[model samples]
Target chain A: MAPPEVHHLFHHPIADHSFSADRGTLAVARENNVELYGKTGGKFQLKDELRGHDKTVTGVDIAPNSGKIVTCSQDRNAYVWEPSPQGWKPTLVLLRINRAATCVRWAPSETKFAVGSGARLIPVCYFEEEDNWWVSKHLKKPIRSTITTVAWHPNSVLLAAGSTDGHARVFSSFIKGVDARPEPSPWGERLPFNTVCGEYLNNTAGWVHSVAFSPSGDALAFAAHDSTVTVVYPSAADQPPKAVLSISTQVLPFMSLIWSSESEIIAAGYDCEAYRLQGSEQGWQLAGSLEAAKGRPGLQDQREESALNMFRQMDLKGKSSDDTKLKTVHQNTISTIRSYEESGGVVKKLSTTGVDGRAVIWTL
Target chain B: MAAVNWRTINIDALDPDSPANFDLTSLAPAVAPVSTADVQSLAGHIRQLLRGGDSEGALRGALENPPYGADERGKDVHLATIIEILQSIRQSEMSPILSRIYQSDGGTEALDVLMKYVYKGMGHSSSATATKQITPQATGFSQVHGRGGSEGGGQAMSVLLSWHEKLVEIAGPGCIVRTMSDRRVV
Candidate 1:
């Protein structure tokens, strides 16, 4: 295996990041603006910056087919940026909630998107052809607290959301005109808008941090603050789930996760490393960490302490030096992990951005 | 009748965070109600297990079924028994016992329940110090306080803190977060 490719963009935390379909353009949420970097000369160079948001931009997602970028911010708003010949044009999305938008993701179909917010609601927004503007239908019932993350099913009709109230719910975001009626699945049959197909609470009632649907869309996986990843398989429309496998770990809680395939999930969080979890409806378990455990240089260097090095270190800082850097690739919490490249329902590469301000591309 | 002015209704006044809407207790896992008598019997059994040098069994017994439906006094009695068992175990035995419990069935939940007791014990120890300061006469009747009551209290607190550290090492910081967020009373 080759080492992961690291890109040190800046010293600021990247709340979210997305790569375009062609893998030529990258959009990252930095502070109050979304920076667009284009691949140039075998490197990602600053191509443009979308500067419309007035508050900390929380999320940014690029539609793979349309190349349209959607961004949400703490200022309680979201914007859709369309690439034109001259430049990217911005259009505001009418998310009527009064609280900040926490996350946004373009549906697989690219015709709609869902925005999770600090308010106890999720707004599934789609473009209105007659009105020529993006309008939102709110999913409000049964949500008691702010939503932390939202993921769209493969069919673009079913949506999964994790909330601070400790519930990971699957709801129908089906729009009458925008989305074609999806085939009946275990989630539901009459997929009307705002229909909640399933709701699951973590065993410890820990606040759910991130949620993702399996590639097949038949299973839902969520990472909660309890350092546990729970996988739920729906049995039928309005019945008990077939299985609810909760894989608890003795590590820090996962902040974000992505399904690399139907049976494998890659999660990253405060541990400053990505971990692989593999299992199925029978059971699931933590396989191990993705990063190979390496011997620490600090430990090796401590054994060979020399007088010349000690004096140099003492003269430089007036005290003996200690290793301040972490042993992992990310020095801080990894906030987002996305499938960079996929083929035949299996992810070939993954990209992750973190508070350490480094975007790393890892090939699997 | 005049048309109702819905615009001036102050929708935010109906706060979603109200007690009715945010009833955290409802999220607790449903368990068969345990009475005070049952808790007392279980505590006695746990004490017997501890006497037989089965500390792991004692710990598991204490954590397996917390008195979720019992009164405050009943729960406190059970909590004191658990603290006694926790303090009796040797420091060297702590990690081994925790690892064994962690690997067993429903081990994560057992650890979570133990974390709740650890936090509650810490809270009681701190509050004991506060009451001793505010009302010195309260400790006058107790013979232990006449010599080194505060010292003993401090020692117990240190023990609880060490247990907390060990628990975190085995269960990760998620245990602390779960204990803090859990609304179920032990």
Candidate 2:
């Protein structure tokens, strides 16, 4: 396979990243602000910065259809940014939670979004037409610990939340007027606010770091700190799931994951590289890493690769010449991965942001 | 309780066709009693590596294998072992070793891995708990004048502070704060 495209942004931890529908603009959560990058030529150039947040911003996402951007931070706040002639206009969202907002995602419909918080709740927010304000309804029934991450189903009403509590829960976020009645599926028929359709925990009870729904919305997969990914297939609301398959790996815990297709999942984290896991209801397994290390490279005998160069590398970095650069593009743990482009329900391109502050896009 | 009762997706019973169930007990270290023989040997190995001036090697040993095994339990074992190694060594012995590691290329990643172990070590009891029980011992360890008083390990955060100082000493001031962002620590 060909190597992925790597973009070295500023050196800092990227908590999360999102790409616009047209794949032209990118939003990344860096420290307390969200920086917007516009694609210029074959590279991404920083075009704008949305700077309203006071604390470290944890999550940022762009609505594909409406072209709106939502960002949440540890400062217990969320904002929705709309593109205007004067750059991007920010509108604060009233997420009534006392703790830090851990993650946020714009729903598939673009009319709503979900914010997972350390307050042990998921607030499903949508605009209030009468009030001209963004109001959130709390999904606060059974979440016992911090909601670490969340993903909306293809239908938008079925929301999947992964929490530090070790639970990957499917909740119905159907609003009366904001959303039309969603078609019944394996999740449930008469869906209402906070209706948890299914909840699954890993065998090790590890914190759920990332969760994703298959394009068909028939399956739910979550990666936990245990270095395992468990896929759950729902049979019905009342029946036991058709199957719950958990695949454990020897690698470090995965911080983020995305479903590329019905049976293919790509995840990465402390390992500093991504891996592909393919499976069905019958079983799942780690196929291998997306970043496979090439053979031991031939030595570069150029002047820069000489003994003096070795000393220069060591004098600057304190290591031998060869060991200074990592084999992978990302120098540190990757925190987030998203589907940058998809067609006919299959993800065609993938993007990841890491603690080393590099954003990379990959083609499947 | 009834409203959320629909979530019964925990797979206690296994399907014969699926892969073997993950051995959660193996990864259950932090909560596991401290008397495990594995913890002692691992601690000794790390100390040996550090004292031998192989800080990067020692850190790699901890990072790659992580005697607790790689999970929550491994996280705890890692935290305890790091503290034990730090507390046992003399400041004179540790500074140069850490300096060498920080000067290395992947030093930033090493610091990050240690920071992760620190975060997991000073963690909430089993994410299911209502409130985070900041385990006092894990949060900050008292400097035990254990070994002819080489140097006080001070506390957990202090160990980090000392590492920061040594990196600054070896390289410069900008070397540390930029490399290790301890925003989550505060």
Candidate 3:
């Protein structure tokens, strides 16, 4: 396989990242601003910066078909950026949340979106043609803690959120006008807003870091701070899930996860690499990393025969050692991973951003 | 064993009152200094042990380090490395190891040292400048500022604070949470 494209943007942590439909535009949440980069030649060049949030910008997402960008920040605000003749114009979202907005994602329909927040609510936002702005209805009945991550089903009605309370919940975001009647699925029919379709906690009761719906939306997967990834398959609306499989790992906690296909998933986090888990209703297991780190070169050729380098290292670093670089491509913890390229309903590539400030794109 | 004896002989000289009784032929300096590099290498070894699922080994390495809680260790040196090692403790395995440490002799002291380093690291990473928040008299709930107990979902500061609560859990009411009640300065 070809080597992953590594973009060392800056020496600051990346909270979240998103790519446009054509894969030409990329949006990254860096500190208090959202930076937009355009793919030019083989590199992503700076295109623009969307600066409004006073606090740290936590999440950014671009709708595939609509090309609209939605960003949320710890400043307790969410903004929808539209591409216009001049530039990307910002439209305020009436999230009405008091705490920091932690993560945001556009529904598959692109008619609405979901914003998870520290306020312990998921704001299901949609455009109101009459009001000429986006208005949000809060999903606040059962969630008891900060919502860390949210995922939307392919049908655009089901919203899955992982939270600090160690619960991964599926709520229906069915708006009366914005959404058509979603077909009956394993979750439920006649889905209403804030309907708790399913709620499954991680086996270890860890703070759920991320959640994802299967490509078919029949199953759900969540990664937790306990270094465990769980997949749940709902049987029916009120019945127990057909299967609840959890695979705890020996690695660090995974911060984010994505479905590569119906049976495979990609999770990345403190481990600093993307790992794939594969299974079905019977069971699930970690397949392995997408790309095993080719450790830093120049190990065997250290025959310079100089005590100077070692002494310099000892004097400067205070250690009598020589290994200088990390074994992974991303030097620090990975905070976010998004599906980059897809082929025939399966993910072909993935883009991961880390606290080390590098965005690496890996081919499957 | 001779080198260890020599180091002990030197440390025995560290007692300022007995300096004149030192053997002139034994030119060993007082206190075998572990360079910043040596401490870091030990931390790296502990990190590998944790990653390899050798929880007992990693715990022993961290909790058994004789020089870890020494006052001479600066912020840029061993303390930061210890904090890094603590951050790598997977939450799934955290309870058992923490309980084991609590059950061991001087476990409270070891945990207090670990907690202090975590807070110090958090203070460095966060812009809030709340390093002084965790003192012997400070109440634990006051740090939340109305947001009730919840672990940091991902942020560094929150992660540090979250571990404090975890430390309190396995170690119980008489553990790190009682820092203000009993200021056992590690």
- DockQ (C-alpha based) per candidate is 0.44, 0.04, 0.02
Candidate 1 stretches with Cα past 4 Å from truth are A295-305, A311-320, B1-11, B15-24, B27-33, B133-147
- What lDDT tens digits, residue by residue, belong to model 2 across residues A52-144? 999999999988888889999999999999989987888989999878999999888889999999877899999998998899999987776
Superposed on the true chain A, the predicted chain A of model 3 yields a TM-score of 0.95
Residue A258: error of model 3 in Å? 0.8
Query: lDDT per model, in order?
Result: 0.88, 0.76, 0.78
Candidate 1 DockQ, CA atoms: 0.44
Model 3: DockQ vs. true structure? 0.02
Candidate 1 chain A lowest-lDDT run of ten: A294-303
Which lDDT value does model 1 have at A131? 97
Q: Report model 3's TM-score to 2 decimal places.
A: 0.66
**Clashing pairs for predicted structure model 1, backbone only:** none
Ranking by DockQ: 1, 2, 3
Find the candidate with the highest TM-score and give its number: 1
Residue ranges of candidate 2 with Cα displaced over 4 Å: A295-322, B1-186
lDDT of 1 by residue, A262-345 (tens): 999999999988999999999998898888665422234446768898899899988766678777888799999999999999
Task: Report fnat, model 3.
Answer: 0.00
Q: Pick the candidate with the highest lDDT.
A: 1
Model 2 chain A weakest lDDT span, ten residues long: A295-304
